[model samples]
Target: MNSSVPYLLAILGEGVVPPSTMVCHGDDLGLLRGDGVFDATRIVTTEDGTSRIDHLEEHLSRFARSIAGIDGPTPDMDSWHRLIEDAARNWRVPGEATLKLVYTNGREVVPGPPRGFLIIAPLSETHMEEREGINVLCLSRGVTSDAFADAPWLLGGVKTLSYAVNVAALRYAKSQGADDVIFTSTEGYLLEGPTSGLVVKANDALWTTPTGTTGILSSITVNTVFEAADDNGVKTATRLMRRDEVLRAQGAWLLSSIRGVVPILSIDGHPAPHDDEMTHRLRVWAGFEE
Candidate 1:
Protein backbone atom coordinates (compact mmCIF):
# COMPACT_ATOMS: atom_id res chain seq x y z
CA MET A 1 0.00 0.00 0.00
CA ASN A 2 1.23 3.47 -0.82
CA SER A 3 2.09 5.51 2.30
CA SER A 4 0.93 8.67 0.54
CA VAL A 5 -2.71 7.71 1.03
CA PRO A 6 -4.27 9.18 4.19
CA TYR A 7 -6.50 6.84 6.19
CA LEU A 8 -8.24 7.94 9.42
CA LEU A 9 -10.54 5.96 11.72
CA ALA A 10 -11.86 7.81 14.79
CA ILE A 11 -13.57 6.02 17.68
CA LEU A 12 -15.77 8.13 19.90
CA GLY A 13 -15.79 6.71 23.43
CA GLU A 14 -13.65 6.51 26.56
CA GLY A 15 -10.83 3.93 27.06
CA VAL A 16 -10.56 3.27 23.35
CA VAL A 17 -7.50 3.44 21.08
CA PRO A 18 -4.93 6.13 21.69
CA PRO A 19 -5.71 9.53 20.15
CA SER A 20 -3.09 9.16 17.48
CA THR A 21 -2.80 10.45 13.91
CA MET A 22 -4.65 7.47 12.42
CA VAL A 23 -7.11 6.10 15.03
CA CYS A 24 -8.82 8.53 17.41
CA HIS A 25 -11.28 7.75 20.26
CA GLY A 26 -14.50 9.24 21.55
CA ASP A 27 -17.29 8.41 24.01
CA ASP A 28 -20.20 7.65 21.72
CA LEU A 29 -22.97 5.05 21.81
CA GLY A 30 -22.69 3.66 18.30
CA LEU A 31 -20.17 1.12 19.53
CA LEU A 32 -22.40 -0.46 22.17
CA ARG A 33 -25.81 -1.25 20.66
CA GLY A 34 -25.13 0.27 17.24
CA ASP A 35 -27.61 3.12 17.65
CA GLY A 36 -26.10 5.55 15.17
CA VAL A 37 -26.65 6.18 11.40
CA PHE A 38 -24.37 7.15 8.49
CA ASP A 39 -24.24 8.09 4.79
CA ALA A 40 -21.43 7.78 2.17
CA THR A 41 -20.92 9.98 -0.90
CA ARG A 42 -18.46 10.01 -3.79
CA ILE A 43 -16.14 12.80 -4.92
CA VAL A 44 -15.78 13.37 -8.67
CA THR A 45 -12.94 15.33 -10.20
CA THR A 46 -12.75 16.17 -13.90
CA GLU A 47 -9.94 17.19 -16.25
CA ASP A 48 -11.25 20.75 -16.50
CA GLY A 49 -9.71 21.83 -13.21
CA THR A 50 -12.97 21.20 -11.37
CA SER A 51 -13.92 19.11 -8.34
CA ARG A 52 -17.57 18.30 -7.73
CA ILE A 53 -19.35 16.56 -4.89
CA ASP A 54 -21.67 14.38 -6.95
CA HIS A 55 -24.49 14.26 -4.38
CA LEU A 56 -23.09 15.74 -1.18
CA GLU A 57 -26.07 17.73 0.08
CA GLU A 58 -28.56 14.95 -0.59
CA HIS A 59 -26.48 12.40 1.30
CA LEU A 60 -26.02 14.70 4.31
CA SER A 61 -29.77 15.29 4.40
CA ARG A 62 -30.33 11.55 4.47
CA PHE A 63 -27.85 11.24 7.35
CA ALA A 64 -29.72 13.91 9.28
CA ARG A 65 -32.99 12.08 8.71
CA SER A 66 -31.52 8.78 9.87
CA ILE A 67 -30.64 10.29 13.25
CA ALA A 68 -33.90 12.22 13.72
CA GLY A 69 -35.50 9.70 16.09
CA ILE A 70 -32.56 9.50 18.47
CA ASP A 71 -32.81 11.77 21.52
CA GLY A 72 -29.47 11.08 23.24
CA PRO A 73 -25.81 10.93 22.23
CA THR A 74 -26.59 12.67 18.97
CA PRO A 75 -23.94 13.59 16.38
CA ASP A 76 -22.51 17.07 16.21
CA MET A 77 -23.43 18.46 12.77
CA ASP A 78 -20.93 21.33 12.87
CA SER A 79 -18.03 19.00 13.53
CA TRP A 80 -19.33 16.49 11.03
CA HIS A 81 -19.45 19.07 8.24
CA ARG A 82 -15.98 20.31 9.04
CA LEU A 83 -14.56 16.79 8.89
CA ILE A 84 -16.08 16.06 5.49
CA GLU A 85 -14.74 19.32 4.11
CA ASP A 86 -11.38 18.47 5.54
CA ALA A 87 -11.50 15.08 3.85
CA ALA A 88 -12.39 16.65 0.53
CA ARG A 89 -9.41 18.97 0.89
CA ASN A 90 -7.23 15.94 1.60
CA TRP A 91 -7.97 14.58 -1.86
CA ARG A 92 -4.62 14.38 -3.74
CA VAL A 93 -5.66 12.35 -6.74
CA PRO A 94 -6.07 14.02 -10.10
CA GLY A 95 -9.20 12.31 -11.51
CA GLU A 96 -12.42 10.95 -10.02
CA ALA A 97 -12.35 9.48 -6.48
CA THR A 98 -14.55 8.57 -3.47
CA LEU A 99 -15.06 10.09 0.02
CA LYS A 100 -16.76 8.07 2.77
CA LEU A 101 -18.27 9.80 5.84
CA VAL A 102 -19.70 7.97 8.85
CA TYR A 103 -21.50 9.21 12.03
CA THR A 104 -22.93 7.09 14.87
CA ASN A 105 -24.81 7.87 18.08
CA GLY A 106 -22.01 9.02 20.47
CA ARG A 107 -22.09 7.71 23.99
CA GLU A 108 -19.86 5.61 26.23
CA VAL A 109 -22.61 3.01 26.27
CA VAL A 110 -26.24 2.70 25.35
CA PRO A 111 -27.53 5.28 27.92
CA GLY A 112 -24.88 7.97 27.44
CA PRO A 113 -24.03 10.44 24.65
CA PRO A 114 -23.53 8.63 21.34
CA ARG A 115 -20.07 7.07 21.12
CA GLY A 116 -19.29 7.26 17.36
CA PHE A 117 -18.37 10.48 15.70
CA LEU A 118 -17.16 10.71 12.06
CA ILE A 119 -14.46 8.94 10.00
CA ILE A 120 -13.57 9.78 6.44
CA ALA A 121 -11.91 7.23 4.16
CA PRO A 122 -10.41 8.28 0.85
CA LEU A 123 -10.85 5.84 -2.06
CA SER A 124 -8.53 5.85 -5.05
CA GLU A 125 -9.76 5.35 -8.60
CA THR A 126 -8.29 1.88 -8.95
CA HIS A 127 -10.54 0.65 -6.14
CA MET A 128 -13.55 1.01 -8.48
CA GLU A 129 -14.47 -0.69 -11.73
CA GLU A 130 -14.81 1.19 -15.00
CA ARG A 131 -17.20 -1.03 -17.00
CA GLU A 132 -18.15 -3.96 -14.82
CA GLY A 133 -21.64 -4.81 -13.43
CA ILE A 134 -23.07 -6.92 -10.58
CA ASN A 135 -24.57 -10.39 -10.29
CA VAL A 136 -27.44 -10.78 -7.79
CA LEU A 137 -29.08 -13.75 -6.05
CA CYS A 138 -32.35 -13.48 -4.16
CA LEU A 139 -32.73 -14.77 -0.59
CA SER A 140 -36.08 -16.26 0.40
CA ARG A 141 -35.71 -16.20 4.20
CA GLY A 142 -34.90 -12.52 4.81
CA VAL A 143 -37.15 -9.62 5.85
CA THR A 144 -39.79 -8.72 3.28
CA SER A 145 -41.57 -5.39 2.88
CA ASP A 146 -44.62 -6.66 4.74
CA ALA A 147 -42.45 -7.93 7.60
CA PHE A 148 -40.67 -4.59 7.98
CA ALA A 149 -43.93 -2.62 7.72
CA ASP A 150 -45.40 -4.57 10.59
CA ALA A 151 -42.35 -5.15 12.82
CA PRO A 152 -40.19 -2.04 12.08
CA TRP A 153 -37.45 -3.50 14.32
CA LEU A 154 -35.17 -4.14 11.36
CA LEU A 155 -34.79 -0.44 10.59
CA GLY A 156 -34.58 -1.17 6.86
CA GLY A 157 -34.16 2.36 5.56
CA VAL A 158 -31.74 3.82 8.11
CA LYS A 159 -27.96 3.56 7.36
CA THR A 160 -27.01 2.43 10.87
CA LEU A 161 -23.74 0.64 11.60
CA SER A 162 -25.50 -2.38 13.08
CA TYR A 163 -25.35 -3.88 9.61
CA ALA A 164 -24.88 -7.46 10.69
CA VAL A 165 -28.12 -8.53 9.03
CA ASN A 166 -27.17 -6.84 5.78
CA VAL A 167 -23.77 -8.48 5.87
CA ALA A 168 -25.42 -11.80 6.55
CA ALA A 169 -27.72 -11.34 3.59
CA LEU A 170 -24.78 -10.67 1.29
CA ARG A 171 -22.89 -13.62 2.71
CA TYR A 172 -25.89 -15.83 2.08
CA ALA A 173 -25.90 -14.58 -1.49
CA LYS A 174 -22.20 -15.37 -1.82
CA SER A 175 -22.89 -18.81 -0.45
CA GLN A 176 -25.30 -19.26 -3.33
CA GLY A 177 -22.47 -17.92 -5.60
CA ALA A 178 -23.75 -14.46 -6.43
CA ASP A 179 -22.45 -10.93 -5.94
CA ASP A 180 -25.45 -9.59 -3.95
CA VAL A 181 -29.06 -10.17 -2.93
CA ILE A 182 -32.33 -8.38 -3.68
CA PHE A 183 -34.72 -8.61 -0.73
CA THR A 184 -38.38 -9.27 -1.33
CA SER A 185 -41.50 -8.71 0.71
CA THR A 186 -43.72 -11.57 1.82
CA GLU A 187 -46.35 -10.31 -0.61
CA GLY A 188 -43.84 -10.75 -3.51
CA TYR A 189 -42.98 -7.09 -4.06
CA LEU A 190 -39.31 -6.24 -4.59
CA LEU A 191 -37.52 -4.26 -1.85
CA GLU A 192 -33.81 -3.61 -2.48
CA GLY A 193 -30.32 -5.05 -2.30
CA PRO A 194 -28.24 -5.14 0.88
CA THR A 195 -26.24 -2.02 -0.05
CA SER A 196 -27.48 -0.99 -3.51
CA GLY A 197 -30.75 0.26 -5.04
CA LEU A 198 -32.94 -1.90 -7.28
CA VAL A 199 -33.93 -0.58 -10.71
CA VAL A 200 -35.49 -2.19 -13.77
CA LYS A 201 -36.46 -1.20 -17.31
CA ALA A 202 -39.74 -2.39 -18.79
CA ASN A 203 -42.05 -1.06 -21.52
CA ASP A 204 -39.75 1.92 -22.00
CA ALA A 205 -40.09 2.96 -18.35
CA LEU A 206 -37.70 2.94 -15.39
CA TRP A 207 -39.11 1.55 -12.15
CA THR A 208 -38.08 0.92 -8.56
CA THR A 209 -39.95 0.06 -5.39
CA PRO A 210 -41.64 3.07 -3.89
CA THR A 211 -39.72 4.18 -0.79
CA GLY A 212 -42.88 4.34 1.36
CA THR A 213 -43.70 0.67 0.89
CA THR A 214 -40.34 -1.03 0.35
CA GLY A 215 -38.61 0.74 3.28
CA ILE A 216 -35.47 0.91 1.10
CA LEU A 217 -33.16 3.86 1.34
CA SER A 218 -34.00 6.59 -1.19
CA SER A 219 -31.18 5.94 -3.64
CA ILE A 220 -29.36 8.99 -4.97
CA THR A 221 -28.38 7.28 -8.24
CA VAL A 222 -31.94 6.12 -8.85
CA ASN A 223 -33.15 9.68 -8.37
CA THR A 224 -30.53 11.06 -10.78
CA VAL A 225 -31.17 8.43 -13.46
CA PHE A 226 -34.92 9.03 -13.46
CA GLU A 227 -34.40 12.76 -13.60
CA ALA A 228 -32.24 12.34 -16.70
CA ALA A 229 -34.16 9.48 -18.27
CA ASP A 230 -36.91 11.63 -19.76
CA ASP A 231 -34.44 13.50 -21.96
CA ASN A 232 -33.42 10.13 -23.38
CA GLY A 233 -37.11 9.19 -23.93
CA VAL A 234 -37.38 6.77 -21.01
CA LYS A 235 -40.55 6.78 -18.90
CA THR A 236 -40.22 6.51 -15.12
CA ALA A 237 -42.35 5.04 -12.36
CA THR A 238 -42.05 3.59 -8.84
CA ARG A 239 -44.51 1.02 -7.55
CA LEU A 240 -44.75 -2.30 -5.77
CA MET A 241 -42.50 -4.43 -7.99
CA ARG A 242 -43.65 -7.99 -8.20
CA ARG A 243 -40.91 -10.61 -8.35
CA ASP A 244 -42.27 -12.23 -11.46
CA GLU A 245 -42.31 -8.91 -13.32
CA VAL A 246 -38.74 -8.10 -12.32
CA LEU A 247 -37.61 -11.51 -13.57
CA ARG A 248 -39.21 -10.75 -16.91
CA ALA A 249 -38.02 -7.19 -17.38
CA GLN A 250 -35.85 -6.14 -20.35
CA GLY A 251 -32.93 -5.27 -18.09
CA ALA A 252 -32.02 -4.36 -14.51
CA TRP A 253 -29.39 -2.24 -12.81
CA LEU A 254 -28.31 -1.76 -9.19
CA LEU A 255 -27.56 1.87 -8.39
CA SER A 256 -25.48 3.17 -5.50
CA SER A 257 -23.44 6.21 -4.47
CA ILE A 258 -20.04 4.59 -4.87
CA ARG A 259 -20.58 2.02 -7.63
CA GLY A 260 -22.59 4.58 -9.58
CA VAL A 261 -24.57 2.20 -11.84
CA VAL A 262 -24.04 -1.48 -12.58
CA PRO A 263 -26.15 -3.69 -14.79
CA ILE A 264 -27.47 -7.04 -13.64
CA LEU A 265 -26.54 -10.07 -15.73
CA SER A 266 -28.29 -12.79 -13.74
CA ILE A 267 -30.81 -13.13 -10.91
CA ASP A 268 -31.43 -16.27 -8.87
CA GLY A 269 -29.41 -18.37 -11.34
CA HIS A 270 -31.40 -17.01 -14.28
CA PRO A 271 -29.61 -14.99 -16.94
CA ALA A 272 -31.02 -11.49 -17.55
CA PRO A 273 -30.75 -10.13 -21.06
CA HIS A 274 -28.36 -7.19 -21.41
CA ASP A 275 -29.79 -4.06 -23.07
CA ASP A 276 -26.94 -1.93 -24.29
CA GLU A 277 -29.08 1.12 -25.04
CA MET A 278 -30.44 1.35 -21.53
CA THR A 279 -27.02 0.75 -19.99
CA HIS A 280 -25.46 3.40 -22.19
CA ARG A 281 -28.18 5.89 -21.30
CA LEU A 282 -27.80 5.20 -17.58
CA ARG A 283 -24.00 5.41 -17.72
CA VAL A 284 -24.25 8.71 -19.52
CA TRP A 285 -26.67 10.01 -16.96
CA ALA A 286 -24.33 8.87 -14.20
CA GLY A 287 -21.23 10.59 -15.73
CA PHE A 288 -19.62 7.27 -16.61
CA GLU A 289 -20.14 7.83 -20.35
CA GLU A 290 -20.76 10.63 -22.79
Candidate 2:
Protein backbone atom coordinates (compact mmCIF):
# COMPACT_ATOMS: atom_id res chain seq x y z
CA MET A 1 0.00 0.00 0.00
CA ASN A 2 1.10 3.59 -0.67
CA SER A 3 2.60 5.23 2.42
CA SER A 4 0.87 8.57 1.78
CA VAL A 5 -2.66 7.25 2.17
CA PRO A 6 -2.76 7.74 6.00
CA TYR A 7 -4.38 4.45 6.86
CA LEU A 8 -6.30 4.10 10.13
CA LEU A 9 -5.41 2.05 13.22
CA ALA A 10 -7.07 -1.31 13.60
CA ILE A 11 -7.31 -3.83 16.43
CA LEU A 12 -8.32 -7.48 16.21
CA GLY A 13 -6.89 -9.79 18.85
CA GLU A 14 -4.62 -7.58 20.96
CA GLY A 15 -2.52 -4.50 20.05
CA VAL A 16 -3.09 -1.81 17.44
CA VAL A 17 -1.88 -2.27 13.88
CA PRO A 18 -2.01 -0.37 10.64
CA PRO A 19 -5.20 -0.86 8.62
CA SER A 20 -3.09 -2.67 6.00
CA THR A 21 -3.14 -5.74 8.22
CA MET A 22 -5.65 -8.09 6.68
CA VAL A 23 -8.54 -8.71 9.02
CA CYS A 24 -10.71 -10.86 6.80
CA HIS A 25 -10.08 -13.72 4.40
CA GLY A 26 -11.27 -13.90 0.80
CA ASP A 27 -14.10 -16.31 1.61
CA ASP A 28 -15.45 -14.18 4.45
CA LEU A 29 -19.07 -13.37 3.72
CA GLY A 30 -18.67 -9.79 4.95
CA LEU A 31 -16.07 -9.22 2.27
CA LEU A 32 -17.55 -11.09 -0.65
CA ARG A 33 -21.28 -10.46 -0.06
CA GLY A 34 -21.41 -7.62 2.49
CA ASP A 35 -23.24 -9.86 4.93
CA GLY A 36 -22.65 -8.22 8.29
CA VAL A 37 -23.55 -5.45 10.73
CA PHE A 38 -21.45 -2.52 11.84
CA ASP A 39 -21.73 0.56 14.01
CA ALA A 40 -19.49 3.59 14.56
CA THR A 41 -19.16 6.46 17.05
CA ARG A 42 -16.74 9.32 17.49
CA ILE A 43 -13.84 9.40 19.93
CA VAL A 44 -12.83 12.85 21.08
CA THR A 45 -9.31 13.25 22.45
CA THR A 46 -8.39 16.58 23.91
CA GLU A 47 -4.98 18.25 23.79
CA ASP A 48 -4.21 16.92 27.24
CA GLY A 49 -4.70 13.27 26.15
CA THR A 50 -8.06 12.85 27.81
CA SER A 51 -10.38 10.76 25.63
CA ARG A 52 -14.06 9.79 25.63
CA ILE A 53 -16.16 7.69 23.25
CA ASP A 54 -19.52 9.35 22.75
CA HIS A 55 -22.61 7.42 23.79
CA LEU A 56 -20.84 4.09 23.59
CA GLU A 57 -23.46 2.06 25.41
CA GLU A 58 -26.18 3.19 23.03
CA HIS A 59 -24.17 2.17 20.03
CA LEU A 60 -23.37 -1.23 21.50
CA SER A 61 -27.01 -1.87 22.30
CA ARG A 62 -27.94 -1.08 18.75
CA PHE A 63 -25.16 -3.35 17.53
CA ALA A 64 -26.56 -6.19 19.54
CA ARG A 65 -29.98 -5.64 18.00
CA SER A 66 -28.54 -5.80 14.51
CA ILE A 67 -26.79 -9.08 15.27
CA ALA A 68 -30.03 -10.50 16.60
CA GLY A 69 -31.82 -9.41 13.45
CA ILE A 70 -29.52 -11.70 11.48
CA ASP A 71 -30.17 -14.59 13.89
CA GLY A 72 -26.57 -14.59 15.03
CA PRO A 73 -25.41 -15.91 18.34
CA THR A 74 -25.50 -13.75 21.45
CA PRO A 75 -22.70 -11.21 21.20
CA ASP A 76 -19.90 -11.53 23.68
CA MET A 77 -20.56 -8.14 25.27
CA ASP A 78 -17.69 -8.45 27.72
CA SER A 79 -15.23 -9.08 24.90
CA TRP A 80 -16.60 -6.13 22.90
CA HIS A 81 -16.30 -3.74 25.86
CA ARG A 82 -12.75 -4.87 26.54
CA LEU A 83 -11.77 -4.48 22.89
CA ILE A 84 -13.14 -0.92 22.76
CA GLU A 85 -11.26 0.06 25.90
CA ASP A 86 -8.07 -1.35 24.42
CA ALA A 87 -8.49 0.70 21.24
CA ALA A 88 -9.06 3.90 23.19
CA ARG A 89 -6.07 3.25 25.43
CA ASN A 90 -3.72 2.76 22.52
CA TRP A 91 -5.17 5.57 20.41
CA ARG A 92 -2.71 8.42 20.91
CA VAL A 93 -2.20 11.49 18.70
CA PRO A 94 -5.87 11.90 18.12
CA GLY A 95 -8.20 14.87 17.80
CA GLU A 96 -11.42 13.28 16.59
CA ALA A 97 -11.45 9.65 15.47
CA THR A 98 -14.13 7.08 14.75
CA LEU A 99 -14.43 3.79 16.68
CA LYS A 100 -16.19 1.35 14.40
CA LEU A 101 -17.27 -2.17 15.37
CA VAL A 102 -17.91 -4.69 12.61
CA TYR A 103 -19.49 -8.12 13.13
CA THR A 104 -20.04 -10.61 10.36
CA ASN A 105 -21.14 -14.18 9.83
CA GLY A 106 -18.50 -16.87 9.39
CA ARG A 107 -16.89 -17.75 6.05
CA GLU A 108 -19.16 -18.62 3.17
CA VAL A 109 -17.80 -22.15 2.82
CA VAL A 110 -15.42 -22.67 5.72
CA PRO A 111 -16.76 -23.39 9.22
CA GLY A 112 -16.06 -20.96 12.02
CA PRO A 113 -17.64 -18.56 14.49
CA PRO A 114 -18.62 -14.97 13.60
CA ARG A 115 -15.75 -12.61 12.81
CA GLY A 116 -15.30 -8.97 13.87
CA PHE A 117 -12.91 -6.17 14.82
CA LEU A 118 -12.63 -2.45 15.70
CA ILE A 119 -10.98 0.45 13.90
CA ILE A 120 -9.96 3.97 15.00
CA ALA A 121 -9.33 6.74 12.52
CA PRO A 122 -9.21 10.52 12.47
CA LEU A 123 -12.28 12.43 11.27
CA SER A 124 -11.93 13.95 7.82
CA GLU A 125 -11.54 17.70 7.30
CA THR A 126 -14.61 17.76 5.06
CA HIS A 127 -16.76 16.32 7.86
CA MET A 128 -15.45 18.97 10.22
CA GLU A 129 -16.21 21.74 7.70
CA GLU A 130 -19.69 20.36 7.10
CA ARG A 131 -20.36 20.73 10.82
CA GLU A 132 -20.48 24.45 10.13
CA GLY A 133 -23.34 23.77 7.67
CA ILE A 134 -24.25 21.89 4.50
CA ASN A 135 -26.36 22.10 1.35
CA VAL A 136 -28.43 18.98 0.70
CA LEU A 137 -30.19 17.33 -2.24
CA CYS A 138 -33.46 15.51 -1.74
CA LEU A 139 -33.62 12.30 -3.81
CA SER A 140 -36.30 9.70 -4.12
CA ARG A 141 -35.49 6.46 -2.23
CA GLY A 142 -37.70 4.57 -4.73
CA VAL A 143 -39.65 2.87 -1.94
CA THR A 144 -42.99 3.61 -0.30
CA SER A 145 -43.20 4.78 3.31
CA ASP A 146 -44.60 1.37 4.32
CA ALA A 147 -42.00 -0.67 2.52
CA PHE A 148 -40.63 -2.28 5.70
CA ALA A 149 -43.79 -2.29 7.84
CA ASP A 150 -44.29 -6.07 7.79
CA ALA A 151 -40.88 -7.02 6.47
CA PRO A 152 -38.59 -8.34 9.18
CA TRP A 153 -36.44 -10.07 6.61
CA LEU A 154 -35.98 -6.72 4.91
CA LEU A 155 -33.66 -5.88 7.81
CA GLY A 156 -35.54 -2.73 8.72
CA GLY A 157 -33.61 -0.63 11.26
CA VAL A 158 -30.59 -2.94 10.95
CA LYS A 159 -27.21 -1.34 10.31
CA THR A 160 -26.02 -3.91 7.81
CA LEU A 161 -22.77 -3.54 5.87
CA SER A 162 -24.70 -3.15 2.61
CA TYR A 163 -24.46 0.58 1.76
CA ALA A 164 -23.56 0.75 -1.92
CA VAL A 165 -26.85 2.47 -2.79
CA ASN A 166 -26.45 5.07 -0.05
CA VAL A 167 -22.93 5.85 -1.18
CA ALA A 168 -24.14 6.18 -4.76
CA ALA A 169 -26.83 8.68 -3.75
CA LEU A 170 -24.35 10.84 -1.87
CA ARG A 171 -21.94 10.61 -4.78
CA TYR A 172 -24.71 11.78 -7.11
CA ALA A 173 -25.51 14.71 -4.81
CA LYS A 174 -21.88 15.81 -4.61
CA SER A 175 -21.65 15.55 -8.38
CA GLN A 176 -24.41 18.16 -8.37
CA GLY A 177 -22.22 20.32 -6.08
CA ALA A 178 -24.28 19.47 -3.03
CA ASP A 179 -22.64 18.33 0.22
CA ASP A 180 -25.12 15.59 1.22
CA VAL A 181 -28.46 13.93 0.53
CA ILE A 182 -31.79 13.45 2.33
CA PHE A 183 -33.70 10.49 0.87
CA THR A 184 -37.44 10.83 0.42
CA SER A 185 -39.97 8.01 0.19
CA THR A 186 -41.87 7.34 -3.03
CA GLU A 187 -44.93 9.22 -1.77
CA GLY A 188 -42.89 12.35 -0.89
CA TYR A 189 -42.45 11.59 2.83
CA LEU A 190 -39.07 12.43 4.31
CA LEU A 191 -36.83 9.52 5.37
CA GLU A 192 -33.21 10.26 6.31
CA GLY A 193 -29.77 11.06 5.06
CA PRO A 194 -27.40 8.38 3.84
CA THR A 195 -25.27 8.32 7.00
CA SER A 196 -27.08 10.73 9.29
CA GLY A 197 -30.47 11.24 10.90
CA LEU A 198 -32.94 14.03 10.12
CA VAL A 199 -34.05 16.55 12.76
CA VAL A 200 -36.45 19.33 11.96
CA LYS A 201 -37.60 22.14 14.25
CA ALA A 202 -41.21 22.92 13.47
CA ASN A 203 -44.14 24.25 15.49
CA ASP A 204 -41.74 24.83 18.39
CA ALA A 205 -40.84 21.16 18.64
CA LEU A 206 -37.90 19.02 17.53
CA TRP A 207 -39.08 16.13 15.35
CA THR A 208 -37.27 13.14 13.78
CA THR A 209 -38.52 10.40 11.49
CA PRO A 210 -39.71 7.01 12.70
CA THR A 211 -37.23 4.11 12.86
CA GLY A 212 -38.94 0.70 12.91
CA THR A 213 -41.41 -0.07 10.12
CA THR A 214 -40.03 2.87 8.15
CA GLY A 215 -36.65 1.11 7.65
CA ILE A 216 -34.82 4.14 9.06
CA LEU A 217 -31.89 3.37 11.31
CA SER A 218 -32.39 4.75 14.79
CA SER A 219 -29.86 7.48 15.44
CA ILE A 220 -28.30 7.61 18.88
CA THR A 221 -27.07 11.15 18.23
CA VAL A 222 -30.54 12.42 17.35
CA ASN A 223 -31.99 10.76 20.44
CA THR A 224 -29.34 12.37 22.63
CA VAL A 225 -30.13 15.82 21.25
CA PHE A 226 -33.87 15.36 21.64
CA GLU A 227 -33.41 14.22 25.22
CA ALA A 228 -31.27 17.25 25.91
CA ALA A 229 -33.87 19.47 24.28
CA ASP A 230 -36.54 17.99 26.51
CA ASP A 231 -34.47 18.64 29.62
CA ASN A 232 -34.13 22.23 28.45
CA GLY A 233 -37.93 22.50 28.18
CA VAL A 234 -38.02 22.07 24.40
CA LYS A 235 -40.65 19.72 23.02
CA THR A 236 -39.53 16.53 21.23
CA ALA A 237 -41.43 14.35 18.75
CA THR A 238 -41.26 11.69 16.00
CA ARG A 239 -43.33 11.84 12.84
CA LEU A 240 -43.35 11.51 9.07
CA MET A 241 -43.40 14.98 7.54
CA ARG A 242 -43.70 15.69 3.85
CA ARG A 243 -40.50 16.67 2.11
CA ASP A 244 -41.85 20.17 1.39
CA GLU A 245 -42.96 20.67 5.00
CA VAL A 246 -39.49 19.79 6.30
CA LEU A 247 -37.80 22.20 3.90
CA ARG A 248 -40.04 24.96 5.25
CA ALA A 249 -39.41 24.18 8.89
CA GLN A 250 -38.17 26.79 11.34
CA GLY A 251 -34.82 24.97 11.50
CA ALA A 252 -33.26 21.69 10.37
CA TRP A 253 -30.17 19.58 10.87
CA LEU A 254 -28.52 16.30 9.92
CA LEU A 255 -27.08 14.77 13.06
CA SER A 256 -24.72 11.83 13.55
CA SER A 257 -22.12 10.51 15.99
CA ILE A 258 -19.09 11.77 14.09
CA ARG A 259 -20.32 15.11 12.69
CA GLY A 260 -22.63 15.94 15.60
CA VAL A 261 -25.30 18.46 14.56
CA VAL A 262 -25.08 20.27 11.22
CA PRO A 263 -27.44 22.90 9.87
CA ILE A 264 -29.03 22.58 6.45
CA LEU A 265 -28.17 25.83 4.69
CA SER A 266 -30.04 25.06 1.48
CA ILE A 267 -32.08 22.36 -0.22
CA ASP A 268 -31.83 22.00 -4.00
CA GLY A 269 -30.48 25.56 -4.44
CA HIS A 270 -33.21 27.11 -2.29
CA PRO A 271 -31.83 28.42 1.00
CA ALA A 272 -33.27 27.00 4.17
CA PRO A 273 -33.57 28.79 7.51
CA HIS A 274 -30.36 28.61 9.53
CA ASP A 275 -29.46 30.11 12.89
CA ASP A 276 -25.85 30.20 14.07
CA GLU A 277 -26.84 30.39 17.73
CA MET A 278 -29.13 27.34 17.51
CA THR A 279 -26.50 25.33 15.67
CA HIS A 280 -23.94 26.08 18.36
CA ARG A 281 -26.36 25.04 21.09
CA LEU A 282 -27.31 21.83 19.29
CA ARG A 283 -23.67 20.95 18.83
CA VAL A 284 -23.09 21.32 22.53
CA TRP A 285 -26.10 19.13 23.28
CA ALA A 286 -24.70 16.45 20.95
CA GLY A 287 -21.22 16.69 22.55
CA PHE A 288 -19.54 17.99 19.40
CA GLU A 289 -18.67 21.25 21.17
CA GLU A 290 -17.41 22.07 24.63
Indicate which candidate wins on TM-score. Answer: 2
Residue 209 lDDT (model 2): 97
lDDT of each: 0.68, 0.87
Query: For each candidate, what TM-score against the reference?
Result: 0.82, 0.95
Please identify model 2 stretches exceeding 4 Å from their true place: 1-8, 11-15
Position 106, candidate 1: lDDT = 49
Scored by lDDT, model 2 comes in at 0.87
Q: Per-residue lDDT tens digits of candidate 2, residues 130-246?
A: 987999999999989889998999898999998999999999999999999999999988899999999998887889999887899999999998889999998999999886787
What does candidate 2 score on TM? 0.95
Off by over 4 Å in 1: 1-27, 45-51, 72-78, 108-112, 115-131, 148-156
